[model samples]
Target: MADKGPVAMIDPSQLMRPEPTFNDKPLQAYRDYTIDDTDPIKERVRRTYYEMHSKMTVDLFKEKREKWLKFNHFKATVKDALIRLNEVVDESDPDLDLPNIVHAFQTAERIRHDHPDDDWFHLTGLIHDLGKVMALYGEPQWCVVGDTFALGCKWADAIVYGPESFKNNPDTYNPKYKQVSICTKKKNFVTTTLYGMYKPHCGLDNLLISWSHDEYLYQFLKHNKSTIPEEGLVMIRYHSFYPWHSGGEYRHLTNEKDVETLKHVTEFNKYDLYTKSEKIPDIEALWPYYEKLIEKYIPGVCEW
Candidate 1:
């Protein structure tokens, strides 16, 4: 991991932009995964993705799902889990260098600004990354953060570092894991094709996505019986799926339900990504409002 060095200071003028910008940088400037060993942030981002793409196999995905999905790790209120994020800085994120808590407030505040009546949307932004508490509890950021893609399928072209990053991944060459189709003559046998183990239009819900905080938090919310609307839960679940949402990959496997999911996730993404360089919110002052949300939607001490 590269040294984070000093936290970059935000320009006051950039704070009040009517549109999203990476501080003084353009929107295109963020999410830069360019490999450059000389650039610490770029190197950090590159290495994280390379490691993720290389090691996130179908088996490991299952193992991680089994490990985290039980929700037996520890117990805490939603607010407490979020506060733990103050200790986490996402290694996979190139844009934001501050603590995850800052980003949480930034996202929620921005959503609140735009959709004042949608309190659930505001709460969704705040807790979207709360699953990142997995980092504090011993999970690597490689698995807990970053863009997620479908496992047991051909790697999509839109993944951060491209297929080259997955050269060492065993699943990359595993015939069973690569894209395949059912054999016409033999129902039990299959032939290699472009949609892997999934049928056409299977919908995103059925796909086994690589393990990440997105899925973890989504499942965690479900396990604890959160009252957030289905759209908000979908936003939390697939917001990290940049390959599908941002890169326009995997349409062959997606269905009408995923089309609706895409709308919610894409809308949630604007606040999640572009707010990175926005003015930092006064977290201490803002907690009361968000705590009320936590109580209403997913309150009290809950299992991790």
Candidate 2:
């Protein structure tokens, strides 16, 4: 199996890195950059986010937590799970319309090319979106894909499309969410006490994020007690958390552990977002190396 691996991992210093290759630069800018109604794809993306913002309330997130965290949905090997993800095309992603598997291979190969020493990182890239298989089991794309944000707290304006996109959301009517302006950091309001009461607060973990494939795969791996390190898990869990990673929101909710984990998550995001282009990876040729990595970290049938 080792004989089929790449002849030599390319060193970063020897390579030239360019922006993600794409034929339609305007339609496919970095990080879902457009929500203009003129473009059909961008319009669909906006509607998807609207649904996500409206429905992903704290109560629903808790219900999904109880349901999915059980880790008893099904069992499949790493390869099987990855292959299953091919059916899903993330509506949240404006970059590529290809199957999810292509993005997985692209991200993994990019990381492998740039950071040869970290085999675990390569595997993390491959399986990061494997939880999108939830779609096959009747889960809607709104819950399975898209950038995630905290559900219990006021929806931050930093989220994609901003808080205005959440106008019709039931959470928007709640008085707690109205207090969102206080935590928004846009005002000079010095007093923390609102009506002589402490506002809702907690660390990152205690806060319930919108349901996403990122959190699902992270929990699945943890339930199986896979050999992946905490750093790999961190990359998996928060890869879609653009609010904190990209927009620089929700810092107060993070703890010391999240601070350390942020470095790895930030590093992983480069490969995840930038590698999505028209490039098609050689799946058959690259399978052996990834097969070996899967065996090393998460062998046998993983409980989904």
Candidate 3:
């Protein structure tokens, strides 16, 4: 988003000492499947991830949201949508056995039959995470997932998995983080506490979440500045973070409405978590049905 060509200036070492395998952290987004045996870029993937995260800051996330979200309008036929989405491949997934396109329709197809009135909701569930395709072409895995922090200052404990990386993250122990957490009426404003950071008792639109496939694709929809059903947008953005929805990690931040929409995020996550297997959809068969669906919702030739 911040013109990586300009901003990616860092020492060669900062680029990560490339290697060939997962050392300790093996893709943790969802453990439903294993890393696929496509070529072994394991070491390169691992090192690249560290370098990206090491350099990333909260401001970077905001910049991306600003740059891309503005072009939220989608112009794609169903075939176009599928083609663009298929650009995403999951080498880290043992489940890469299926093409990435199937992953979406697999989920969307299920939702279509079960929840037609909620078809848009189903489509959101289907297409929301496709933004992870950015990693398919060599974006670092860290940039692909998310970290929890306040971009202006420091990091948060809630950035998933191993916590050691934040120690050197400049903002790790910033006094502002401590001060803000204790002082603000809008308490726990850091990315760590997602609860009240979002609008309480109102809708899911107010929540600031750890970035991920959910947030990226949601940005695509949001930047167009189209009129989104508040609940639908919320469901799109926060679907990946389970600590909030499942563990109630930041319950204090939640108002009545977030709870309600979270019920919706939860419903969507169920489809994401449960829907997948060796099974592949007949993409050719589903094309016509989806052409109508895509033509209706998206215009062709998206910006990327």
Candidate 4:
């Protein structure tokens, strides 16, 4: 097997570096969002979310949070939730024919085999795209995985496949996007590259990601900081921040810290995209290893 194995074992650097990619494809990669093929089942879901977002005025956020700020009723163990969440299958797209779990395991396994010494990176292969679970977790397809950006702020032309409504945002009209904002240091918000970053908050817990598995899971992690590392949580957070990966979406927003973080994120993206194959890894074969890996990093059961 070694004879046919990848000649140059994937280094963490190779895995993170920017490359020619179409990772979020057919759904018109790196664009706003995807359609539900008008499938009745999918369409119903689409309509529900559209109505939710449309009616989800800034006021609603306050109302919803005030009511459910302490609600843990919906939360469950990761193992229990993952079993149900894994039911979300997406083979109809032309990309690959594996179940979502297989796709995730495949990404993780490849990284494991490629970067033997970099254990953290191997773990990344496992969790990096797990955020795609937003599809099965009851999130609207549009809000789950689209070009993510600062929701209330002005939109940047650099945001890959950004939403059309952002055009009407007050910040878009502000001088910053077209020119520069006198108040803000980076003109926009993120940095010219993903290399630099700011704490933005005490931790990534305060950052905004598009509403998807990434953000949802980050919520789980943020709430349980004692159980995981800041690094692991960030993996859950930025895996889908496609703007930085595809091009430099939020250049001005990044600070010195984000720059270092972006390097690791960039490395992980390399493995996530290139190692993809149609053949799903035998889950039975991988399960034991992943079970141990999960134990090492995350709580066996997570809030979902």
Global lDDT of each model? 0.84, 0.77, 0.52, 0.49
Full candidate order by TM-score, most accurate first: 1, 2, 3, 4
lDDT of 2 at 290: 98
lDDT score, candidate 1: 0.84
- Give the number of the best model, judged by lDDT: 1
Q: Could you give candidate 2's per-residue lDDT for residues 77-113 as a string of tens digits? A: 9899898877888887767788999999999998998
TM-score of 3: 0.65
Q: How would you encode candidate 1's per-residue C-alpha lDDT over 72-131 as one tens digit per residue?
A: 999999988888888998998888888999999989998998899999999999999998
lDDT of 4: 0.49
lDDT, residue 105, model 2: 98
Off by over 4 Å in 4: 1-76, 90-98, 131-138, 160-207, 226-228
Give the TM-score comparing model 2 with the true structure, all chains together: 0.84
Q: Is 3 or 4 the stronger prediction by TM-score?
A: 3
Which stretches of candidate 1 lie above 4 Å from their native place? 1-24, 179-192
Which 10 consecutive positions of candidate 4 have the poorest summed lDDT?
A: 5-14
Better candidate number, 2 or 4, judged by lDDT: 2
